[model samples]
Target: MTHDTGLVITGLAKRYGDAAVFQAVDLNVAPGEFVAIVGESGVGKSSLLNCMAALDTWSEGRITHDGVDLGQLTEAQAAHWRREHLGFVFQAFHVLPHLDVAQNVALPLLLLNRPDPARVAQMLDAVGLQGLGERLPSQLSGGQLQRVAIARALVHKPRLILADEPTGNLDPRTAAQVMDVLVAQARQHGSSMVLVTHSEAAAARADRVLHLTAQGLQEPPQQAVSAPNP
Candidate 1:
């Protein structure tokens, strides 16, 4: 099947042995759109995001981004694809402990062999970490570390962003700040974003909020209202 410039998952499913993690999952994230997935703990929201990133396997159906079929790529090919076109943010703020904040943010550009110090600086400023690039992750607060992760993920301007509970580790006020940065950067880059979170406040910022169940994704009963654009 043909797809335009966006993410498309069709009839996707994941399993281990006889247990099904989720099945019949279908989703489409348009370019520059922000989508949030929410579910109870152990319901595979993170698994679904991993599958979208091609970092994990799915049992059935297809996942495509900008017309490229992820399932058809080999492991090496998948790595290359991710390096070139994907940005990921994690709740754990997976910055390298040894690398200073700037170096950590620049890793993605370095991997693509297109390092741009200006771009790195721009990202740091955009995320409100303007002057802390020289500090180690250990020296920063939880919120600051998460901002570092956001800057790093967005440094290369990936077409798709997959964030798994990025604000889960922060206090409510910090989480809101992080979301503001994340949403602004995603908008600035015009990247499609798929965020999985348990926080209703985080999900409320999405263009569409869907609930993930073992059967598939569906609208929540109340249907989360998207926050107005700032």
Candidate 2:
């Protein structure tokens, strides 16, 4: 398939030894669109996201972002590509313990050799951590820490955002709040997002939702509706 300004995955598959994790997966995410993938556990949902990010290898298929084919990139090139164009939010809220909130959010910019404290502050405010940038991760609650992850993911204005069960660790109320911030920031930045989750509520917010299976992605079958008595 031809690459446009967003992410494309064509006939993708992953395997370990002789066992297939998933196969025949195809997806296209338009710029500024939010797509969510839902599947049962061990169906390789996280693995698919990793492949898109170039953090893992696929047994077959092509993944391209904005015309750059991921399979062709060397290790260093992939790292550079991720730094420049990808933002990742993890379920665990992977903020560094040694660094304060602002420092954690500033890492992507620092890696690219472009430090923008103002941008960092803006992201903090956007995620509702306006004045808590000086607090350590240990000092914050789980919900607050997740906000820090969201800020860090968007601080560098990545072209694509890949989140792996980002709300899995939060309570229902906090999960809703976190999704609100994440969706708003991703929209504001015009970043195409692909989120893999088991949460029906989370998937409901996406522009489209697909279920992943070994055979490929397809829309979930609709639930039956009963006729009411007249």
Best by lDDT: 1
lDDT of 2 by residue, 23-118 (tens): 999999999999999888999999999999999999999999999999999999999999999999999999999999999999999999999999
Listed per candidate, the RMSD to the true structure in angstroms reads: 2.3, 3.9
For 70-139, candidate 1 gives per-residue lDDT tens digits of 9999999899989999999999998899999999999999999998999999999999999888999999
Cand. 2 TM to true fold:
0.95
Candidate 2 has an lDDT of: 0.91
TM-score of each: 0.95, 0.95
* Runs of candidate 1 exceeding 4 Å displacement: 1-4, 223-230
lDDT of 1 at 192: 98
Q: Which stretches of candidate 2 lie above 4 Å from their native place?
A: 1-4, 224-230
